[model samples]
Target: MLGLCMGLAGVVWAELPAPSFTLAWTHTIEKIRWEEDYRVTPSGLLLGEARIKGSGAGMEIPDGAELREGAWHYQSHLPPLQPLRLGRTPEAGDYQLCIDQRCRPLGDWVGPPQADRPALELWSCETGSGAG
Candidate 1:
C-alpha cells in the first residue's frame, strides 16, 4: 500500500499546474507596430516581434509601426519587459497565453514557438476554479 501511495505522489509531482481553458492558436499576424523601441532583459524571457495577420487593409497593428511589445504575461505572472524586435517569426505551435499589463488580442505566449502547421492550443484555468 505504501508503495502504491508513493507512486501516485510521484505522478502528481510531475504534472503541470492545471488550467481551465486552453487558448487555441487561431492565426499568426505577420508583424505589428511600435512607436518607440522597447528593451527587456534575459531572465528566462524572450524578445521578439508579434506578427498578426488578417485585417481590413490586409494587415494592421495596434499602433502603426512594424513591431509593438508590452510586458509578457505567463499564466498570471509578468516577468520583465522583453524587447520587441522586428523580422523574427515564431514557429507555429500551441502555446499558453495570458493577459498581463497590456491588453491585446495576442496575449503573451508560453512554451517553445511552433511551426505554422499543427494548430496551437493554449491552456488557462477559469477564475475561482480548479482544473478537474
Candidate 2:
C-alpha cells in the first residue's frame, strides 16, 4: 500500500504547473533595434528556449544583455514594473517600449512571439531622427 501511494503521488506532482510570465524588450540605438523575449517561471528563470530578434545595419548584443534579469524580480513582485520600472512590461493594455528615458505606446505586433518569429513590433526609436 505504501509503494502504491508513493507512485500515485509522483503522478500528481508531475502534473503541477509552474507559475510563469513572458517578458520582451527592445533597445533601439540610432536606426537599429535589439529585442529579446523570455518565458519566466516563479523561480525567475527562463522556462524554455528564449526568442531573440533585431533590426539594424551593424549592431551586436550589448554586454549586459541577459535573458534573466533583475527586472524579473520587479515584474514578479506585488507591484508591477510600471512608472517605477519603465521600459519593461505595461500594467494593462497594449505593449510598450522605452528608449533614452522616453516611452511610447505600441500597436499590435506582426509575427509570433518567438525567436525567429518574435511577438508584436511593440515600439520603435531613432537616434535624433525625431521621427519616432
Candidate 3:
C-alpha cells in the first residue's frame, strides 16, 4: 500500500498510511482556517485542492475560486512536488493532518520538533519501510 514518509534533517523518522490526506492549519495573521488536499503519486505528491475559511491579507481568492459553504475553494494548477516541507515552530502552531475523515496533530505522527530540527519533510513512500 502507498504511504507517507515523515522525516527530519534527511533522516526518516516515521511513516503513516496515506493514499491521500488533507492538511489544515490556521493563518497566523488572519486566524482563518486553510486546508489543502494532497494525493500521493508515484512521481511525487500532487496538490489536488485548496480551501480557506474567510480571507484577509495574503489570502486573496484565486481567479477561478468559488465561494461555497462559507469558504473559498479552488484547485491548484501547480505540478507535483517531490517533497513538501513544513515549519514546526510555535509561531506556526500545529497542523492537523486528516485522513479518511479522521484528524490528528502532525506532531503525533513524527513527534515534536526539536530546536535543531524545526521543520518536517514529507514525501510519498512506496517501499515498505516504516509504513503503518
Give the whole-model CA lDDT for all candidates, comma-separated.
0.26, 0.27, 0.82
The true-versus-predicted C-alpha distance at residue 60 of model 3, in Å, is: 1.4
Q: Over the stretch 1-132, how does candidate 3's per-residue lDDT look in tens digits?
A: 677777855577877767999999999889999999999887667999899998799988889999999999999988887678888876677889999978898888776656666888888875465542
Tell me the deviation in Å of residue 28 in model 3: 0.9
Cα lDDT tens digits, model 2, 39-120, are 2222223323233343245544444445454222111223221111122223223333322334444332221123432222
A best-first ranking of the candidates according to their TM-score comes to: 3, 2, 1
The clash count of every prediction, one per candidate, is: 18, 6, 0
Q: What lDDT does candidate 2 reach at residue 9?
A: 12
What are the root-mean-square deviations of the candidates from the true structure over C-alphas?
14.8, 19.0, 2.0
Best of the two (2, 3) by TM-score: 3
Candidate with the greatest lDDT versus the true structure: 3
Off by over 4 Å in 2: 1-26, 45-132
